[model samples]
Target chain A: MKIVKYEDIVLKVKLACLQMTTDLPQDVQNKLEMMAMQEDGQLAKQMLDIIIENANIARQENRPMCQDTGMVVCFVKMGQNIQIEGGLLADAINEGVSLGYEEGYLRKSVVNNPIDRINTLDNTPAIIHYDIVEDDVLIIEVAAKGFGSENMSQLKMFPPAAGIAGMKEFVKQVVIDAGPNPCPPIIVGIGLGGDFEKAALLAKKAAIRNLDEVNPNEKLLALEKELEVEINNLGIGPQGFGGKTTTLKVNIEMFATHIAGLPVAVNINCHAARHIKVVL
Target chain B: MATIKLETPLTIDKIKDLHSGDQVLLSGIIYTGRDAAHKRFIEVLEKNEDLPFDVQGQVIYYVGPTPTKPNQAFGSGGPTTSYRMDAYTPPLINKGLIGMIGKGKRNDEVKAALKGHAVYFAAVGGAAALMGKCVIKAEVIAYEDLQAEAVRRLEVKDLPLIVVNDIKGNDLYVEGPQSYLKEHK
Candidate 1:
């Protein structure tokens, strides 16, 4: 069994938070530049230019790209052979998040109550998800989730007859209704199959995939591409100023479901899409 | 397209001349307030006491910024959703505040209030880091207990903002989309 020191996890989490929140990952930058060239509307193109400039300024200055630096969410994969020594694992992760937000000058956007809505101050107590895997390494995936795109996320349980066409229609409608609010061109993460909550989770997880990646299943990839074309064709454009590039990518992650149900969920990630991973 | 650079406290005449959709480069003193601050401001007004800051023609930014580094003035200062403050805005408007800086839609009541009084403008939503460059000076004016919700008196220079709502009741959120939306054949 591999023994992982608790401080090591803390260090990794802190580094991951700072890196994810402050920097625009290269894949997203490449996609943004590509979309910029393809964007035809002058106003939408200008908005895209400003967004790109924001990314550059954010990276160079070690500042957050958006003021809504977002709540911290960590996806942890624990290995069967690994044992955490020293401090509690969750506390270490939270400590790392607090340090990262403080040192990086990112905003503490989490409120204690959604109703009273008092600020949490440190952006601590990240929303964490853990999965025990067969491997021997601990994998930490940190994503800085902003409110704008998150507000636009939706899920619906469909009848079995709804099928692929229904899913496509639902996604298209969501994008069209979302318009420029999610910050186009968006990455549409479609989660199919699974139960209601699981489908929603799958949709969110799908957002973490790289923009350049294609779904491995050919039929699913075809559906993704078709959905992509229809969404962009809506003319919602960048910042909803009306342009050709409404979506940068469409990624679908599916799972086997019960015999009687079809579940679909859509989670939109803005152009910033800050995420990073660490293996320890 | 007209721009004004002014210091507080503002007069109604200065803001009355301004219309919605007009570009302005604001400089000098402005206050920072979001949902929390607005609620408190209204609460104080309910007690019939003077607001923490005089409202006449002053601009309020609907922003909750990240805390500053050790010596920096502010961190990641960007606008929040304007609509959240819609319920608290009309009363502030009647009190003499002239402008609001924020992103997204405002409620009809807020629009109606703006029309009743000459007011409304917005800074770009996602442009926080870039916008921070223009905020040359900032300090907490009142409600320090509010933390990020505290009202900050900020001195800006050439801060770029578009007039989204005019005295004539024009709304850019509605107009911008209407003008650009293509009809699907």
Candidate 2:
């Protein structure tokens, strides 16, 4: 069995939180650069340039790229052969989040309760998803998801009759309706199949996937390309100032579903798509 | 496009001269508030009490900044989504709030209120670090308990913005997209 100390996990999570908040991922930065060159509108081009400059400034100064440092979401793959010593895995991750936010001077955005609306102060109790795997290693993928785009996400449990065409239309409508609110030049993640919650989780995962990575599924890859073109045609542009680049990329993930149910979820991510991964 | 230079406590004549899609470099003192602080502002108004600051001809930026590090005037500060504060905005606008700096769309009532001698400007959302450099000074003036959502008085120099909504009811979000669609078609 492979043994990992609880404090080790805490340190990794804390560093990931601090690093991801300030540094724009390389793939996202590349996509932004490419889009900036392709944009037809002067305003759109200017906005993209400013966004690139902002990323550079954040990196140079080690400052949070955006004021909304976001709620930390961690997806963990834990092997059955691995044993965590010192404390529970969840507790370790939460402690790391609190320390990371405090030490990095990141905003404590979490509220203790939705209704009560009081600040948690430490940005604790990160949203964690666990998957047990056969390998003896533990992998943690972290995403700092801002709410401007999160608020724009939507899910639909469509009947079987809705089909691919219905799904396409639904995705298009979601982006159209979102307009300027979610901060345009967005990344779209589509999750198809499974039940409601699973689809949403899949969409969230898809949203944080690296832009340069290729999808192994040929059909879904083609669909992603088609949707990208269609959405850009909507002319939402950078910051919705209007241009050919409304979305930087469209990523889709799918799974098998019940015969009667065709569930779909869409998660929109702003240009500051912040995520990082660590393996131990 | 020529960039317009603007100062705070905007006049009616200045607001009327502005148009949708105009780039602006703003300077002088402005107040900051987002969801929680805006709610408190409304509550205070409902109680027939004075606001933490005078609203007349002043601009309220919809932002909740991160905590500042040593030797910095402010941390990464950028505009939040403006639509969330739409419900509370019309009342503030009616109380002589002449300008707003934020990102994204405002509701119809807020747009109408803009027609009543106000303007809405959109800063590049998510460009917080770059935006922070423009804030020469920041101090929390009210709702200290709200933490990041506290009302702050900020002095900014050459803070970049785009006029999204002008007093004549022009909306850049609508026109900018429509124009692009037309040109491509």
lDDT of 2 by residue, A1-280 (tens): 9999999999999999999999999999999999899888889899999999999999999999999999999999999999999999999999989999999999999998899877889997799999999969899999999999999999999999999999999999999888888887899999999999999999999999999989999999999999999999998899988889899999999999999999999999999999999787
lDDT (0 to 1) per candidate:
0.79, 0.93
Q: What is the per-residue lDDT of model 1 for residues B16-98, given as tens digits with 9 covering 90 to 100? A: 66655456777878899997888889899999988988878788988777777776666777677677788998888888888
Indicate the TM-score of model 2. 0.99
Cα lDDT of model 2 by residue, B13-126, tens digit: 777889999999999999999998899999999999999999999999999999999999999999999999999999998899999999999899999888948999999999
Worst lDDT 10-window in candidate 1 chain A: A235-244
> TM-score, each model?
0.90, 0.99
Displacement of residue A262 (Cα, Å) in model 2 is: 0.7
By DockQ thresholds, what CAPRI class is model 2? high
Model 1 C-alpha lDDT per residue in residues A164-233, reported as the tens digit of each score: 8888889999887676566667888888999998898889888777776767899989988888888877
True contacts kept of each: 0.41, 0.87
Q: Tell me candidate 2's fraction of native contacts, as a decimal between 0 and 1.
A: 0.87
